[model samples]
Target: MSEPVVGLVVSHATLAEGLVQSVRQIAGAEADALRALSNEGCGPEALQKSVRDALGDGPGIVFTDMPSGSCAFAARRLTLDRDDTAVVCGVNLPMLLDFVFHRDLPLPELVDRLVSKGKSAITGSCREVAGHGDRAAAG
Candidate 1:
């Protein structure tokens, strides 16, 4: 009955900026939807308030870049008090695109889909080499 929410927390301005274009192309991820965790060259909570403020009274998801980073911790803390919010770490373009494309899906369902796609996108060194080798084999 309400619009979904999505936010991002990044380690650095440069890395965040780098993801902007790719996110735009895949998921229509917006600049306004992103929050920098290290503004003023300080710690994590700097962007938490801004992110919370941006999502005022809305039920949606938050995406953080690293699992062990402060951004993820802060996000976890924020959502701990709210039943309507979901925070996911290690977010990638495929996950975002899946979320955007399947916007009509239920919240829990969206989370599962995003996680599934995101995990599947991860490839180890051997897997990467094997994938290329398979391509070469086909050719």
Candidate 2:
């Protein structure tokens, strides 16, 4: 098999580490390919370098906690000229779990699957779960 697609999770404070820790706790061996970086004391340039050093030369994804946050900005900047890597915002436990298991897939395919898995993991409201609009309103 080819080299597994690794991931660098970047988040504010200790969020990144917490997510990676959770993945390690739950996924065990499968979580080996994922790492974490926090933007706690790092500025844009520093964050960028930290991410760059962590990623090196490899086909991987950078998972950011927010779409418009420092982590996302840094990751986006670092990967602008690279095709082997991609930046994924809104990092979460479900997404990380998906990444750990499906790392062997091609980069593009892996990105698609990770995004899909991440989106699918999001859910809210019991009313929405049951039904919405006229049907739920009447019932």
Which candidate tops TM-score? 2
What ranges in model 2 sit over 4 Å off?
A: 30-32, 127-139
RMSD of each: 3.8, 4.7
User: Each candidate's TM vs. the true structure?
Assistant: 0.73, 0.86
For each candidate, the alpha-carbon lDDT, in order, equals 0.65, 0.87
Model 1, 1-139: lDDT tens digits are 5465554545445555456556776666555554333433645566667566655665667777778666667677778788878888887767766766665566788788889999987755566577665453431
True-structure lDDT of candidate 1: 0.65
For 95-116, candidate 2 gives per-residue lDDT tens digits of 9998898888998898999999
| TM-score, cand. 1 vs. native | 0.73
